[model samples]
Target: MTRRTLHAIRHVGFEDLGSFETPLRTAGYQIEYIDAAERDLGQLEPLAADLLVILGGPIGVYDHDSYPLVADELQLLRARLAADRPTLGICLGAQLMAAALGARVYPGPAKEIGWSTLDLAPSAKSQPLAALRDVAVLHWHGDTFDLPQGCTLLASTPLCRHQAFARGPNLLGLQFHPEVRGDRFEHWLLGHASELATSGLNPVTLRHDAKRYARTLEQAGTVMLNDWLAKLKH
Candidate 1:
C-alpha cells in the first residue's frame, strides 16, 4: 500500500506544525513542509498530496509587497482547489484560500485575539464541522473572508462571519487556530507580544487562560482532525 502525502506550507519561523502533525504521522502520511517566507513558492507545486495543510502566519494575506511569495502561494492554492484535492487552510492560510477563490479578504471589525465561541451554521450540523457546535476555538486573526461561491459556511462568531467554510468534500478553511496546543500557544504569545498590544488584547491574560484551555482545545482538535480524515476516505 502507498502512504499518503501531506504538503504543509509554513509561512513563518515560529509557526510550525503543531497537533495536526501527530495524526498525520500516525496515519502514515509523508509530511513535507515548504517555508513560504524563506523559499520561493513558484518552484513549489502543490501536487502529489493526499492532503495539504496551509498553516497560520503573522502576516496578512494582502501584504504581498513585503512577502512576495504570497502571490505564488495563492496561485498554487487555486490550482489545488481546481484539482479538488483534500486541503486545509488555517488562519492566514484561510484568508489566502478565500482570496484565491475570488472572495474578498479584508480587515474584520476587531482583532479576535483569544479564545472565543463559534456558532456552527445550521447547514454545518450535517457536515464534518458539526462537531464545532457552540464550541470555543483559539482565535488570533484580524482578517476574515467573504463566503466563496458554492462553498458552505460552517462556522462563525460575532467578530468574524466566515470562521470556517468547506468547499465540496475535501477542502476546509478555518480562521481560528484549532491546531494549537499548550507549547505552541505559549510560543505564539511570547513571540507576538507586540501585536497583542496593537490589537488591544493583553498577552498576560491570554497566557493565564492558555493552561486552562489547552486540554479542551486538544480534545476538540482531535475530533476535528478525525472528521477531516474521514472525509478524505470518501
Candidate 2:
C-alpha cells in the first residue's frame, strides 16, 4: 500500500502545523509544507497529494495585490478540487477556496477573534462534521465567504452564517481554526495584537482563557480530523 501524501500550505511564518500534524503523522501520512509567504506557489504544486490542507493566515483572500501568491495558490486549490482530491481549507484558506469556486469573499460584519460556538446545520449531523454540532471552535477570522453553488452548508454561528461548507465529498471549507493548540493560540494573539485591539477585542481576555480553550479546541480538532480522514477510503 502507498502512504498518503498531505500537503500543508502555510501563509505566514508564525503559523506552523499544529495539532493536525500529529494526527496525520499518526495516520501514517507523509506531510509536507509550502510556505506561500516566502515561496512561489507555482513551484510548490499540490496536485500530487492525496490530501491538501490549506492553513489559516491573517490576510484577506482579495488582498492579492499585496500578496500576489494568494491568486496563484487559489488557482492551485481550484485545480485540486476539480480533480476530486481531498482538500481541507481553514480560515483564509476557506475564503480562497470559496473565491476559486466563483463565490464572493468580503469583509464580515464584525471580526470574530476568539472562541465562538458554531451551530451545526442539519446536513452536518450525518458525516464528517457531525461530531462538531453545537461545539465551540477557535475562530480568528475577519473575512467570510459566500457558499458556492452546489455546496452544502454544514455549520454557522451568530456572527457568520457560513462557518463551514462542503462541495462534493472531497472539498471542505471551515471558517474557524481547528488546528490551533496552546502555544499557537498565544503566538497568534501576540503576533496580531494590533489587529485584535482595532477589532475591539481584548488580548488580555484571550490570553486569560487560552489554556482552557486550548484543551477543548484540541478535542474538537481530533474529531474533525478523524472524520475527514475516514472519507479518504471512499
Q: Which ten residues in a row have the lowest lDDT in candidate 1?
A: 128-137
Write model 1 residue lDDT over 105-207, tens digit each, in one string. 9888888888877888897877767665555678988888799888999888887888999887788998998888887777897778889877678877888
Q: For residue 196, what is the lDDT in candidate 1? A: 83
Stretches of model 1 off by over 4 angstroms after superposition? none
Q: Relative to the true structure, how large is the alpha-carbon lDDT of every model?
A: 0.82, 0.82
Q: What TM-score against the true fold does each predicted structure earn?
A: 0.94, 0.94
**What TM-score quantifies how close candidate 1 is to the native fold?**
0.94
